[model samples]
Target: MDEMPALDKMIIYLDQLAISQIFKIKTGTYPSEAPHHAFWTEVTNLLQQGVLLQQVLCPASDIHRDESMVFTRGDELTLTHEMLGGDTSFRSSSEIEGDQVWAYLRGFVSGKEPILDLSVDSILDGHRNEWLSRLHISAAMDWTGIAKDVRDRREMSADNMVPLYERWRADPKTSFKSVLKTELESFGSSRVTAYLHFAEMARRGLGSIPNQFVE
Candidate 1:
């Protein structure tokens, strides 16, 4: 059988867990007034941090009637599989050993934690702050010159790699999958190994793993 593409694999992994399921939010006017940006930003952060499996918004609805203060009701919130977009599809890694690769990707992109907690507001707030911090760090690191350092350390001569490297560098919006594939090919690393390394890095940054391979 032909091996599935890396991105397809990620999507399949997410689909298996039904993580694409849509959920709803029910709250009082105050909570409902929370901006969509705040809600989504929090959800994405949680997913990235492995806090939530999936993050989706609830369907829009009109107010039916105003109810008087009822302690029993106290703003009901329900999560269901009815809010996801009709055309939404997973795109990341294939399922491997029961791990939802797409779920991981969703978390990566959304910056949300994996474990879902009922304290939506608090979780969202934390994620927002974390997201801002990450942005700041990334912005600062943009001038690190690490890419040049790594290129210089590589054994392969730049003369031979000029063409390909130039093509990649010239592209303003290079896709991550394409970049991963290119780097793996250039470094003579197997796709699986490269992906494993990337996953580990996502879980634990550089130097977290002592060795790349284990006996």
Candidate 2:
């Protein structure tokens, strides 16, 4: 059998969770699907640091009654099928750290070690200020030079990547996915890594996504 694409791997990781399955059955909308921006907005809120998986399963924020189109009843066979192959460990109110949520992608993208600060900074160069405001970090650290430092790494030289980051900065309207696609291809990373990065970063209210790249 062919290996699953990285993006699908990430999607399946989410889909295989019992809570995510309930979200699908009750909401009748995939996390990637639209018409439920508010739903996902709340979901992303829960995905932030410190929030537990059980809390996300029943967020403190109320779901707008009108927006919830519960086409699949909770006890339905279809819903059961969805959860049959899911990871049900969280059904017991087990705490899920934000890091644990995207662990699958992190493992795939950079192996056991987390994505380095240098690589993360490179991806968020133009948008660092916006990202830093939301993500708490040491104020004393010099973040201004991180992008350049990562770009200067010897491993990236063969990919001719320096120009790409410049181009992304030059074009304010560039779709993040487009830039990410190029980077992943050049760096020999999977497309799933790009989408996983996008799900975490681009969706962080930094900027408008180009229509062509809409989920």
Candidate 3:
């Protein structure tokens, strides 16, 4: 965390693809004659100024860091991921989904509805303005290990999806409610596992768990 700004900043999450376009424009990797180049340049300039002025907070997550690894380190496309994010880091989607599932379960157990908030503020590391530091990588990573892990995960996913599709085909659901129970159970377990992976990352300082948040 860094010193807090006097005002709360609005959160702006840039999509990975748009970030890549901006990088291409800035690095001249995209043709100057391309009509779309000017649009990205303006966007890049606006966001840079907004972040620099503390008028907006752009928090990146482990998802961004991991996805950027598709490009080699120091690649123009790689640095694009960092330009506006600075030191701000957000919770992984896995953690948020887990929290959602936990909330829904608690609501069912207590016989009272749980109103879960899965908004940006719920996952932010600190005050909106506190992470306004120089450009920083949101997660500290072991690139080689991550690369291998990704390959293995994809291969395993391909194999597992076969049974998943087989189960769906056998079920023959005619309505959303027909499969709601199975969907909830399946996703709840998946979310828990994903959250645990994030929990491991948090231990290494790549992410944060709020003092009051529970898995």
Candidate 4:
């Protein structure tokens, strides 16, 4: 027997949980009303942990006010990378590039579900958030390297730098002072000491060490 690819497993799990229950719960219908079975709770938990991705089903619903639609039906949905404790990475259907996964999804929902017509090709699209997520991850890794360099230079005593390391994490606005303060506190170094040390290193034409030093 061929083993299922990891991506396929993820899609199957998401399809089962997202499609099956989201419709009923969001629609406020009794068919999906059991608190224990509510899918959003699980979704919320995943989102909090940055383990689940949320794609908006588009062509927004236009249901008759009188009808009780179980889920928000749409022709398209977006795929995004949910970051733990940070913003989400949004990707369009076009971004998803797995033919086997698409085929599996089509087969999985072809005649079984009313709202999902997997036959309709789903396009993977790109969003600003996707770029933002990448940028955030990049900056975070870079800052971690810088912090570790500082720690190694000063021989500071700290178990893990994550608390202060998070200062470089993505935010709407970037503030050098905020980042400096966080690094100072985390490394147990004063602002002058840290700045002078880094400045001297820069003056000496010493470029940032490779990230592998910390990782």
Best by TM-score: 3
Top lDDT model: 3
lDDT order of candidates, top first: 3, 2, 4, 1
Tens digits of per-residue lDDT for model 4, 32-115: 456666557566455433332423222111111101122134211111222321232223333343344455557768854334
| TM-score of predicted structure 1 | 0.17
The window of 10 residues in a row where model 3 has the poorest summed lDDT is 133-142
Candidate 3 Cα outliers beyond 4 Å, as residue runs: 1-5, 74-79, 134-142, 151-215
| lDDT of all predictions | 0.35, 0.39, 0.71, 0.38
- Full-model lDDT, candidate 3: 0.71
Query: 1-215 in candidate 3: lDDT tens per residue?
Result: 89654767888887777777777777778787898888888888898888888788666776666556655642455455555666565888778866887888799899999988867689977667664655454434547656767667667878977875677788767455656687789977886798789878878663365656745
Better of 2 and 4 by TM-score: 4
lDDT of 2 at 193: 69
Q: Give the per-residue Cα lDDT of candidate 3 at 179.
A: 60
lDDT of 4: 0.38
Backbone clashes, each candidate? 29, 2, 0, 11
Candidates sorted by TM-score, best first = 3, 4, 2, 1
lDDT of 2 at 17: 44
